[model samples]
Target: VALALCVIFNNSPVGSAISLIGMMLCLAGIFVLQQAHFIAILQVLIYAGAIMVLFMFVIMLLNLKQGENEGWASREKNLLLSVLTGFLAIGILYKISQVLFSVNMDTPASLPDSFGTVAVIGETLFTDFVLPFEVA
Candidate 1:
């Protein structure tokens, strides 16, 4: 959805911003699915909130106008792209089908019960991730 918005509405800053927000939410959903609730919340709060606000501020301050968003290719080129995309989609579906036949999908045995807790994230943030966090 986000990519479609970006591609189809290249002339609109609002469209790009909305796409960015959608991407952030999708990332947050992936984090939640991975049991990283703290990271998911932070993703929405920091990247979606603060960074998006900054981007909008920059866009507003620059007073940028919409640019040309015309397609560069002819109908034949578009048809070729459509065919390639169809093949890619079929390949992706095939990979997903293979997952159903797989037998090994369990979590690693070394992962602790506290792996996804706020405390664990906090500890790691203040320790191993401290330098990068500070730099940021």
Candidate 2:
């Protein structure tokens, strides 16, 4: 919802950036509630802190100003983009509907005692995702 509002306020660059940060923070909170503390910390530190600061810096550095009555594009281009977006949205909805109708709501399998433990997660991270994890 906050992200949708941010997109709606595209004319205000600083406001949009601020709202984007708010949305990231909200996601971090959700992660915390899901017991993914490391992911939550990463979300706040990497997304809300570092990336947003860069975005704000660029916005300020560019000194963007919106002109009165200015459109994002000419009418023809806007119409083309709207048509494309509508088609994309329809495709996504169709895929979602298919999944919803076809899903089998079976009883979930039981998890092992070590499932979601820090040590287990750490082992998988170091073993399977070493390069990408180290790069991050």
Global Cα RMSD, each model: 3.8, 4.9
Q: In terms of TM-score, which candidate is strongest?
A: 1
lDDT of each: 0.78, 0.81
Query: Following a full C-alpha superposition, what root-mean-square deviation does model 2 have from the true structure?
Result: 4.9
lDDT of 2: 0.81
Error in Å for residue 43 of model 2: 0.8
Residue pairs of candidate 1 with colliding backbone atoms: none
lDDT (tens digit, per residue) of candidate 2 on 15-74: 889889989999999998776777788899999999999999999999999778565555
lDDT, candidate 1, 1-136, per-residue tens: 4355354545567668768877888989999988899999999999989998899888888888865656554565567667767887898899998986774667554767898998887898899999998998
Q: Give the TM-score of candidate 2.
A: 0.58
Give me the displacement of residue 104 in model 1, in angstroms.
5.8
lDDT of 1 at 110: 70
Q: Which ten residues in a row have the lowest lDDT in candidate 2?
A: 1-10
